[model samples]
Target: MITTVRDYLAAHRRAKDAFPGALLLVVSVFASMAGPSGWHGPRAAPVLWTAAACAPLVWRSRAPVLVTVAVASVEVVHLASAPGQPLVPGASLIALYTLASRLPRRRAWVIGLVVTVALTVALAASRSDEVFAAGTLASFDLLVLSVALGDLTRSRRAHLAALSKRAEQAERTRDDEAARRVTAERVRIARDLHDVVAHHITLVNAQAGVAQHLVRTDAEAAYQALGQLKDNSRAALDELRATVGLLRQDDDVSEPRTPAPTLADLDDLAASFVHTGLPVQVTITGALRPAYPSIELAAYRITQEALTNTAKHAGPGATARVHLDYGDTALRVEITDTGNGVRAADMAATDGHGLIGMRERAAAFGGTLTAGPGRGGGFRVVAELPLPQDPGDAR
Candidate 1:
């Protein structure tokens, strides 16, 4: 019961129009009872007029202009009946304030001036005394004060609403940015896993085939092939573990054991392809220089993916070449294979995510990548990545 009463009181506080009306009613009753000695009117006359004036205030917020006019009209009648009474009552002030708060400044002020003038004239005509008495001036001042206070309240509410809208927009923008970053990170992780698994598994599959073929005729050759297969499997597992480690939560204390691959690891990569019976020749044109870790990683992954494709599609006697050109402004990586293995039409029809991943990686650094048939009847992929102006700025 107490909680119910508290809730009721809270709701009543939020709706304050009734409270003011009740207070004005009580004050008007008391004022009527305490009228001056010269007052010979009926005891109920002033009370009825005051009650009519204050009752309209209940709907002030819903129809502020109508309520203000009704209350002002009633007060004017009451003043005419009893000139010695107050010129403007609390109900009139409340109605005027509601009008000013609800309507625009020009309309509210114009209506307020008209009502003030009408009430002043009524009070002046009823009083055979001074035209502009102190009570009339005070009433005018109170009316102006009510309009000013109401306008201030309206301005303050508008400002707070604008601030709330801006805060909401900023929150939405932040959420969108965070979602974009999360999506980009997921794509990067998936691409890395694909590259690692595809490169190592391709070599392991080839070596397993070789080992199986040599098991009966050449035991020594079979043993070496099996060893290479084991090494390839182990390397694939290591890389898979490293790539998957990126998904760990911030609280995880363990770190990836092996670092990311770079251009320096190209020789080992070429050797692995050679082990699978695909000859890979690596050529560097420009002077070697340090590059950002991200650029190096992208370059290495592109080269690895290109060679993997070459091994899988390039038939017997097909050789691959990796050319790295380090220019002053950009680093270019090109991978080409002899089309004598897979026909140009078959290679063009090949659909896979490797090329897509490479393009994404290059574009991430504001670079460009192109893959098509080379002029020498071979498949070629060229990627050019811009370098920072200062070598020291590379990260």
Candidate 2:
């Protein structure tokens, strides 16, 4: 109940209930006085002193030191005129506390000490009150303590407010960053979808037309075209689902599709090349672990692109060597095919987008890649993918 009342008063004092009560407090303290000689000595109208003391409270927040001096002066006069009644010590104490808390501690202590000493001396000279009242000094002590407490409270509140504001600002920054990343990712997925869909759609439509044309002439060739179309369409559907569902799925969206090709599947990749009547040797220098999804995908694409180029440019009997070296910091793969040893100018002049895409994949993982002609005789592609610290580090 005491705490509740105090909180209520503090709220009211800051807002509405302070002014009227303050005026009354000033009046009640100075309204009547017993003169210095036990005869209401040197008594003047109490109303003037009341107004003088009350005037300072209005300036409490703006001019703490000046208001304090004014209130102290009025209190000394009242004490001189009447030593009989106990001065209420009301708003003066409040103003004194505000002064101490609002001002620097050293300044408050200096001013408060001066007020105490001067008041004590005046009372002594008047022979009205003693320089040292048995219990009167306690109020002055309370005043000094109030200064320290007020200063401490102000510092604490300011620090907390600063910290809270910084935390809120940081949270807003994180949310904005996340939103930007999401937008970029969505845009990237859209582009990938367009390419993947468009490429396979063209193939499927062309093959379907071939199948329809051959239905009357050679059924075998038509069936072969239809089979290729089925495979192409299914692959496109599965890959699209994997890429698109990444945005919608909650669990393990980072995980690639179940049959997603890894370095382990490089044998199958090699078989495809070997079936094309090329001498393709895949050499694994070290044990290959299941790498991060992104790294694995990059490695696979690099290998596949290199092999496809060998078949297209190196002719049927060209020798190809794919070297996969797993190292401490990164996985290095080199694909060299005897594709008439592309000249520096030729590699530079080759299709623009393939080289750009390959470089993009390498850059995404802070890796490096270089493609040019081998010193012996052929085009060579070298890709180095820096292995991540793994998901455990993230956890």
Candidate 3:
């Protein structure tokens, strides 16, 4: 029965208002019957006054000032009609509390003081012999206490509301940050796949053509071309497997079979192009030193993409040169071809995916990449990647 009543009060606002007033009326009526100087006239007068005072409390929250005035006025009349009744009515206290919590501090205090003074004066007047009795003083104290408690409740509610808003903002910020990281990871994976597939597949297609042509003429050269095709295909598969491994969830137990390619693998990279009948000469101008793995990988992929573009678009009889220069602050990688490749105008008009990927990779590492026709003739791709101040910091 208790749980059912509690649920009904929680669900209904009208029930919350009526429950307290109903209980106060019932308790006040019962207590009035036992008082020493109760009901000097008709016994029903004091009961009617008590019921009237408590009834206004049902609208205390809705019209606190009016409700408080009405209740206090009725209590004063009740005290005059019956002298030695309860000094403070419970309904009056409830009304004062509602007024303090819902209104501003200065206004609430002003109104509360006025009501407290009015009730205290009425109580003292009812007891003509004892003007400043213990009951009058105690009634004043209870009224002030109710107002203080109401203001405290209001402050606590405000504090909890502010805390709830802050928590929601923090959760939203975390979700946005997670989404950004996921998008960046997706773009990085796409670039890796593009570089791997484009570079090796171009070689495989060229080698297959060479083998088909040579098989009709020179059997030995055709066998060598076929062998190079097999190697290029295997290399493509290994790099693809490594790039795809990044998609696995954190709980995944599998690991990539091959390590990421770096500048150290440049020789093997150039040899693959050489087998496709393109002459590539790699030149190093400065002292070789360790660099960040990400930096080296970007440089290697940039070089590979540049050379692949040269072989595919640079007319026949094209020879490409790759230069690596390690300096005090940065590492420079440049690829240039002798054959007249796509003109600058045409390259700009097309805006191929390879150039976009290269630029993105360089930008990711706080570096820069520029691609266009070289000074004399042919295509050129130059990427400048910053090196760490201390070589030991390279990872």
RMSD values for the candidates in order, in angstroms, are 3.5, 6.7, 3.4
lDDT score of model 1? 0.84
Flag clash pairs in model 1. Answer: none
Output the lDDT of residue 36, model 1: 54
Q: What shift in Å separates residue 267 of candidate 3 from its native position after superposition?
A: 0.9
Off by over 4 Å in 3: 1-7, 33-48, 61-66, 80-84, 104-107, 124-137, 253-255, 341-345, 348-351
Clashing pairs for predicted structure model 3, backbone only: none
Candidate 2, residues 1-395: lDDT per residue as tens digits? 97986777677644333463365554554445444545343334555565667766776767788888988888788767766545545556666667776787688878877876665555454545565774456655665666666677767878899999999999999999999999868755764565455445645665677688888999998887778778777877887887787677566547556465678777866764443346688899875565687788778777776676665567546889899998877899999987787664554466444555567678878999998888888888999998655634311
Off by over 4 Å in 1: 1-15, 29-48, 128-134, 341-349
TM-score of each: 0.88, 0.66, 0.87
| Cα lDDT of model 1 by residue, 65-169, tens digit | 999999998888787777676544678788878888888888998998888777767766666545478866776778778888888777788899999999999
| Candidate 2 ranges beyond 4 A from true positions | 1-51, 80-85, 123-130, 169-226, 249-259, 267-294, 305-321, 326-330, 338-367, 376-378, 385-395
Residue pairs in clash, model 2: 35-40, 35-41
Report how far residue 174 has shifted in candidate 3, in Å.
Answer: 0.3
Rank list by TM-score? 1, 3, 2
Tell me the lDDT of model 2 at 197. Answer: 58
Q: Judging by TM-score against the true structure, name the best candidate.
A: 1
